[model samples]
Target: MSIGAVLAQLRGDFPDVTISKIRFLEAEGLVQPGRTPSGYRQFAAADVERLRFVLAAQRDHYLPLKVIKEQLDAADSGAGPTAALPRPPRRLVPIDAPAENVGLPVADDFTVGKELRLTREELLEQAGIDAPALAELQQYGLVRPGPAGFFDPDAVLVARTVKAMTEFGIEPRHLRAFRAAADREVGLLEQIVTPVYRHRDPEAKSRADEVVRELAALSVTLHTLLVKAGIRGVAGC
Candidate 1:
């Protein structure tokens, strides 16, 4: 089943289910659809059933994805598909713990929640930026959120940096190059890790994560040294 077929099958009930939303849920580890050599998503009937469970959990039970994902994970491991699952409380969304991604480790201590959760209003206030400014940052691909509608801590840092740059008259448009460069770096990294991630081995996933962290650290170091060298050229010292 192609992604389009899955969308068509689900969208009658889940009208807001866009392709990106499905991809976001995949990123959250909700469903594992196979991908083609050309990177097209291929959903199976089981994937559709899982997607339905997620939608029903959110819409009928009013459960946050975190809680729903836990139940799903339990079921996937041994609880028997959709059997003997605990009923979720019909309540507002709670503060979420950090999610373990394919390679991400446990959350580190940060002033903001270690999971990097922030509502839009909270991010604006903390970053000392306005809504429009934040919107511009997102528009320029400098920041983004998951489908769960929470910004990561990096988004707040980006907002703060952009705000400070505004003092020097640097605007979001001028930051497009930064976004482009970051995208290129990510593309290269993805090529290196995609095969490891596709493997179903726990150790492979761990190795992939280590590769990600080391490469990311190296990239940052290179960026910092280049910036320093550029500044020295202006200082002439």
Candidate 2:
């Protein structure tokens, strides 16, 4: 079908999509459109399906374009969809064996664990996040455990973040700033996604997800670079 017709159908599902966004995805090599003899764009059924998959993954996984590119690369290599799967498990080795005796496990051989919901206590124990950290996060509204005293999937993520911060010598009180910073960051992200929310189109949703992932990665990279640069300047001074 013509690009306009296909895009119209897509817009029915995701309203905020723009020609620019589709062009941007094309520039990123995420989607390739065919050209008619008249130079108008033509998209086939498979192209629409591929676009749907790309959008779904971006929305759901928040994967960066580089990561998505790697996944597509794997597919191109005839490795099947297994290469797109999550990281695999470490191989079991006997502790008593010599260092040279152990063989590394294949990178592709990994297990996908079931999603586990943890209670407050279970989350603390499993994630090694202290009580004070949990309390601090709660105070900052970074997370809320369910009424059943169990943490949803997001709480597990919070628990992991708390654990990592502690390892970095960040005290619970010091971490409160992160909660505020996160709130501000989320506010910005919401504004960015508003267009997608308003349109409710599949392609717009996909574009929203792609934008979010790219923004997040760029945020992290820029934040880390600036922080390190500041630290170096201070040390040199």
Candidate 3:
């Protein structure tokens, strides 16, 4: 089928489909459209299906292009059916011998074992957070243990900070206010990052990261000014 006809059909499913977006996906190696002698792009039925899968995964899963690429690569490598989209590759590296000495592990260098579920004590040790502080953050609804008593990696990082704060005599109740403030900050960030969620372009992905970091810096600046103003207000100066 011609690219335009494929696009027209795709627009039924994705109303905002644009030529540039398709080109961007192609550039990301998500879809490979054949070209005619006249240089017109030709998209087969399989191409349309691949685009549908890519778009659906992006919209529903919030996966980035790099991750999606890895999934597609894995599928292409006989890991599974090419048409049956898989989740992002979980293996840290590929499963094969290296062609040359690259100072990296060959797939056989690593051992694959059954997923080990960590206990609460092991989790605390790995997360570098004590029990009490973890409970405090849980009370504040800032973080929670995931399935099987594990915590998300990001949550573990935050838990460590909460633990450190407790060592400095900061109570969990006091941290609850900070959690509320953080929610507001995150809401602002979501507003700015929403556009990045719409398409799967590498440039847009980079800009999204920059936008999130910039928003975080802006939030810190605004909060500092507000705190300073409040302090001066109390001092009657």
Candidate 4:
């Protein structure tokens, strides 16, 4: 079956499942669907079953992707899909606390490329925000559609994060600072990269891409550390 057909089959059970979520799971190697010659996904019966198991484990058991993958591996190894799986304890962190085990930023984390093309409704659904909230985000210039009038995948992430922040009393209007900061960072990065990116050498584009990725990672790291330091000062930690 095509990916859309697989999505349709899963939607009755997993209403929150979007194409991006399925693509993310595939990227994580949970379901190894075959690809056609034109690079389209083709889900076999086994693939759909694997997705069912993964989604069920996540919804019913709150299993993380790592644990879910281990279970899938065990099943693939003839242990049966019904084999017992381990469950990790979930912990709640304070809102002001930095996340645990964030680790060091990596270039790949900031690599700006994706194939997602979501409609406005898909973005709202995936982001868990209502139409009014989306309009607010647009008003603040925090979220935007691409030239093709479809949202980039990152917009979903941005909208989701903004929604979560709203729980802390942060409004979309207040997020303008964030958008401005990001714009400034992008402008700075562009100034630094455009020269190398426009070089006459054959390898210029590749080298420029690598440089931008590394710089982007470093910029985020710097911003995170600064925020942590400021928070510590504010909280007298």
Which one wins on lDDT?
4
lDDT, residue 197, model 1: 85
- Scored by lDDT, model 2 comes in at 0.63
- lDDT by residue for model 3 (1-237), tens: 887788877665554456777988998889998999999898988888788778666544545567777877788797856655533332222334243313332211222245455566776787777787577678898786766676555576677677777789987788778889989888988987988857698757755664565456556656765886799899998
Per-residue lDDT over 81-189 for candidate 1, one digit per residue giving the tens place of the 0 to 100 score: 7554333333122223122211222111111335868999989999998889989999998889879999877888899999999899999989999999989987987
Each prediction's total of clashing residue pairs, residues at least 3 apart in sequence or on different chains, is: 0, 7, 0, 0
Query: What TM-score goes with each of the models?
Result: 0.51, 0.45, 0.40, 0.57
Reference-based lDDT, each prediction:
0.73, 0.63, 0.68, 0.78
What TM-score does structure 2 among the candidates reach? 0.45
Q: How far in Å is the alpha carbon of 33 misplaced in model 3?
A: 40
State the weakest 10-residue window (summed lDDT) of model 2.
Answer: 103-112
| Worst ten in a row by lDDT for model 4 | 86-95
| Per-candidate RMSD, Å | 18.9, 17.4, 17.3, 14.3
Candidate 4 local lDDT, 46-129, one digit each (tens): 788788877766655535567779878877888855544333232222223444415647555665675789999899888988
**Candidate 4 error regions (>4 Å):** 1-102
CA shift of 197, model 4, Å: 1.3
Worst 10-residue lDDT window for candidate 3 reads 101-110
Q: Which candidate is the best by TM-score?
A: 4
lDDT of 2 by residue, 1-237 (tens): 776776765554433345665677778997788999998888887667656555545544655566676776677678758433332122123334445433332111221246567777887786677788778778867677767667776677776876677788976567667678767876887888777757856656655666665555445445555776799899995
